[model samples]
Target: MARIKETFDSRAWFMLECDDPDCERRFDDGQWYAYEDDLLADAKDDGWQILYRDEHPELERDMQYCPAHRLPECSTCTNIMADPAGWKDGQCPECIKEEIPNERS
Candidate 1:
């Protein structure tokens, strides 16, 4: 697949593909992922691996499972607020600390 590199509203974006060979979903917008914070970092921490293009570091993007592949629930809280790519050991950091934000804004 071609590397994705684009900007919208002054924000830079890279392309993301699903790891599942059967579900090679691609996403250019970060919002669709619905990460708790720091999309890349959070995704990585949650066990999602990123694919890097050394030749195009600016376009280095991570591989993530689409919502259809994500598990719903905070492993620790047993709450349906966990993001498969943003949780660790089946638990979310926010839920572990009991500090999940109330709103996105």
Candidate 2:
């Protein structure tokens, strides 16, 4: 976590620290296991931002990095209404926890 911490609504917010977007592994010998790792990696690359907290000469040593605010759900889950009777689009911890297990390619 960064010193200047803030919360936002985005699916990425639910991600745990150890989760990786570029991991390669096999599961049940079924479909290729890539969606999760890929999504995470892409999000990190696309969302991360670099900033300098100091002025002039001190800028380089006082750099900070953070992620861009993203929607609470991925493109597919963003449309919570898609499953009106099933999942509710809360974007909170509860909602995120439930959705975490269902991410797939």
Candidate 3:
């Protein structure tokens, strides 16, 4: 499951963070606006199970992570979302590849 950290900026816009210990992706205007309406819905639809939701009063945002999506139980596989190998430049290379499939035959 992937953990999402939600915080409010000065303008009251929702700021999101991928809270996986190894993941450094943060969601601000670009991600927020694009998935504002379907963030949770899409997550749910993708078979991601929410482990828990926490409210950070000091941060002024709700933080939630889906262990099912970010962290899997496979012994041979590491958390892809975390990108522990540093192969991704703050972006998951595997995820990017999955998003844009290669058309080459």
Candidates sorted by TM-score, descending order?
1, 3, 2
lDDT of 2 by residue, 8-84 (tens): 54333223231124323212223222344553344356553323233324343422222432223433444312122
How many clashes would you count in candidate 3?
A: 10
Runs in model 3 deviating more than 4 A are: 1-12, 26-29, 34-37, 46-49, 53-69, 72-105
Count of backbone collisions within predicted model 1: 1
Off by over 4 Å in 2: 1-34, 49-105
lDDT of 1 by residue, 11-85 (tens): 655555565558765544444433324556655565554444453254434334555565355545555442355
TM-score of each: 0.30, 0.16, 0.29
Best by lDDT: 1
Task: Give the range of the ten consecutive residues with the poorest summed lDDT in model 3.
Answer: 74-83
Ranking by lDDT: 1, 3, 2
